[model samples]
Target: MSGHSWLLKLPLGKCKSTFNLEKAVCNHGFFMMAPNRWIPSSKILQRPLRLADNTTSVTVLISHPPDSSFLCVQVYHSQTPSPADQRAILKQVTRMLRLTMRDETIVTKFQSICPEAKDINFGRIFVRPLSLKMLSSASSFAIAGKRKRAKSEKLTTHEANNAAPMGNFPNFEELVNIDESCFLEKFKPILGYRAEYILELVEAVKTGRVSFQDLENSTEEQLCYEQVYQNLAKIKGFGHFTCANVLMCMGHYEIVPADTETLRHIRQVHGMKNCNKKTMEEEVRKLYDKYAPFQCLAYWMELLDRYEYKVGKLSELSSSRYHLISSVLFQEDTSNK
Candidate 1:
């Protein structure tokens, strides 16, 4: 599509809208979803967005608000997304908008102060992988013997392509190795006492005690963070942490996945003391203020660490080590799949 500069809307008060399609294809190039900010890349133009769960996915249609309106678009990025990335994308968009408009206002945090400025320039953006390597790398402590380099070393885009293999991402189940008991064990301590309970529940479905197709068909029966949270809450073993971890492991069956280090970063940077849904949502908005578009994964990781650190679990582990472990593990598992 040709640039529709005049079609772009100007900033108004607290107005944000999300389109189902990828924002890069939208006229503005900068996806304008209120309260969330995602700057689109020129290299890639469009992507699909799934809405109403997996029942429907569409190429998003973003329009200039009928009246005087401010717009922002949030897009879901995944190896393969099934609508669970909303919170992460929201956070990223918020951060990107904040960074792009940072100089514009002191009072208006996320809302743009410059409503009249026709063209705003926000830089290149991409999502950070939540699999083990980046997190483990961020948490690693083996730097004692190595000399410090003046510049940071990043994975070459080519290496990243080999490791991550962009485009459609793998679903959660496909990404994890079920045969590795040790893998389960690494996540077990973090799973808390409710581990056995969740495992039984998953086994029931996997073993056909509960029909998989039936459960996936039934909105209420399908296992995921929200459903599992409600189901496991009825039992005694599943506390908040346990339930959250189990939800993370369920893969495509359910997703409430966020890790410990990311959560810690959110708490430290955003000053959130509790992990209540509202507070978490607010933090998501704040993250959108900094890291638009790719902020979803960034938000998830930061919040994961925040939750873990607040509960004193993630702090003990070397941040980069965990990131490296997760990175290598995620890569190994995903690549083979």
Candidate 2:
């Protein structure tokens, strides 16, 4: 069994009308659970059958269950191996893919594609829920110091107890409630709203006893968007843009998250007239089956929307990005294996 690793490109052309990249990789020989779509691994492996005359690329992508890292693997091959060998190589590739996809950087990169996502700030987004003890011993180093640890060496606390410092454990709301001044004092060199503003907003709420309900109850006239966002920013150490983002975190915004481009195209180009929330959701889910559960679905939708807005038809958007990726399929010799 000779072995080598390299990044591979996706092979084009297939006949299946509903060709699913995510399902093809994630399923258990078409006999497993309904494949929940997501990005196929960024890194993949390809093994060629000695008798077959085809090239293959196996790409894999995974997301954490709620608060886990994103995993991606992309494998390319210039040959097609026998069915038995292909299965064996796939098992090995998946094992490594699982580990590499868990890298914090990979997770952040994946989330960054979400339409609602503003940025990927490790300290503010994923590592702020650390307990004092856990922070000092585990999380503090990740957020404060300059030491390099293995990618897998994360700072997570026990689930049952506030035992260890964890990374990306805190939800968006929790991130907004950290101590701003204290965080700034500890990590002065850091310069961003998340690291700085999130803490400030949290402190303001605590100091003023402003529960989440208060933010929601306030009227459009009583607390205009600009006013509310500005108030959030003025908290000691918070910036203007950061405060606006915090308000959204507090459930004040109507931002729908997905890969905007594909969604937009599905409607505009695909002749989806008067697409409502439910329609969008269903279509988005279907595309997720096609594209996998990518956070960038919003991007795909947005591109379609823009195309229709400009050309008065979805054809422009259809001919390129969305159409190409969504339509093609590969006919592997499942009959042999």
Candidate 3:
């Protein structure tokens, strides 16, 4: 665990006034998932980042010193990371924090449209996709395959006896080059039919059946969101919810990834009593149409507020309490009865 430590500074640019590290990192549930840890005491976000070598993972601590204008990324490693490795680490951190000018503009515009979100600075947080391959697999697993206790128990067992810790979840290159048997064996705990979907996505990428170049470059002119959505729909196990979630990660926010929870939110918050599975999409579209391109952000802002109302401030939530999040939500639902 011994390693050299050094800091790399990234300027906040126009985002300095709007950015709050705690608010940005804790704004999303993915922060509670594997590999990402937000230390409340130190006000540092720590995670193990895979270097360019792909084999070497260095622990990185990201913090913004009080009254500082730049983010400090402290790399803990056996040696200073090469320039490429440093770039890789910074890229991941930037993606995780949505530190781009475009992202800041999105938040600014979103808040103007939805005054309720003006104070909270919603839509500024995002989870790292790592790569399209990982996004496909992880988003599928999260939205479709992950059940509360059942999946958690299975993943715990897998982590204990079979696969690497969740922190080292396979990267895009690893997934592409991984032996099919090894991939199946490593992910069997949560794979189920998701294995087929993940592999199908990998093969699609391998064969150039689907292009992620535009997404990687963040080039909206070259990206057709609907085409991507249609292509993803062709993959087994990718329904509307999963595809919308993937598109949202890729920066298309016109659609909300509605689920049972969304239905509840609409019924209770929006006063839409007849909103069920069949009408969920239409109802949500009508309700959040005012937000237009940032519909998902507005919807998510309300949802996150609801979660905080039930549990507590997400920024102050302890890592140890992450597991109880689902139960707490369930309890809120039942208690209303």
Candidate 4:
């Protein structure tokens, strides 16, 4: 594990014209979550990816040159990965960056209708969560770890233990095989109830009650949005907001997750004083209806614009500063409006 790293270059193919690694990785908050690190100085994203064997996870440094046709993935490991491992690494990177032909088409179509989105390459963004299981685990991590902090707060010993340079999540199958206590012990400092829901979802997937193939469109025939929505809704703890967010990650963008952030965007950007929780979804739908199938992307671009405006470039925002990225930090002044 101490030898020189091996580099693998993946051609961008149809996505070459629009793929910008910085925009792709930096546009989403998920990139700031555990295990993913973006270095601003070098414009490289580093993350530990679990190989197909489910036993070995390798740290990979990913970057794309300004006009190059290939995306460079540098695997930091003692041995060169086998062909299977290389495919696994590339697959994970592709999923994380949304670099498929379908994604390129979505970006092209989205920009054609919303010209303002072209500059930021909104379609190239939307990095998928490492896995659905990781989302729940990460959420539990965030919730149970919340506390008041000063601007210069140092990492506590507990936090330091949890914040391994190479993150601590096991592969999906590996996670499914673990007993409840083992799972909890591994994901220490997590909300107990949140951890329960994560286990439940994992069990459901393992038992064929819900299929990731259907959710992620790995099947030969694609399931309609309604079908996928209903499937995800059956999972405990997956409300409208969670389902929609998950759906967006799965490449369905017609539905936007209308949380408090959406309400804030509606109020500040659209001047909707009365857009409360009840009317938030309706208001957001109306705002981005023109974007149609790409409604989430459109809404996300607006939010990203406001975020970067307030916090400066996300690429430059250190991973250590991720804890400071709360809604209050990006809240805009709207009293005069």
> Would you give me the overall lDDT of model 3?
0.71
lDDT of 1 by residue, 1-337 (tens): 1211112222534322322123212222122222112323222222223222321222222223344345433232222323444433333233333322321232132123222111222211222222221121221111122222221122335433422211222222322223335535754686764455545644554454544344223333444345646654544455655555533332221223344544544455565646444466456556554533233324444343333443333323332333443454344334533
In Å, residue 78's CA in model 4 sits off its true spot by: 1.8
CA shift of 127, model 1, Å:
15
| 81-182: candidate 3 lDDT, tens digit per residue | 789888877877777788887788888888889888877667675677366532433311222223223222122332233222234455455567567886
The predicted structure with the larger lDDT, 2 or 4, is 4
Q: List the candidates' TM-scores in order.
A: 0.26, 0.24, 0.82, 0.82
Candidate 3 Cα errors over 4 Å, as ranges: 1-3, 53-55, 129-166, 176-191, 214-224, 335-337
**What is each predicted model's overall lDDT from 0 to 1?**
0.33, 0.33, 0.71, 0.71
After superposing candidate 4 on the true structure, give the runs of residues whose Cα lies further than 4 Å from its correct spot.
129-165, 177-192, 218-220, 327-337
Q: In candidate 3, how many Å is residue 244 off? A: 0.8
Candidate 1 C-alpha error for residue 69, in Å = 6.5
Alpha-carbon deviation at 297 in model 1, angstroms? 21
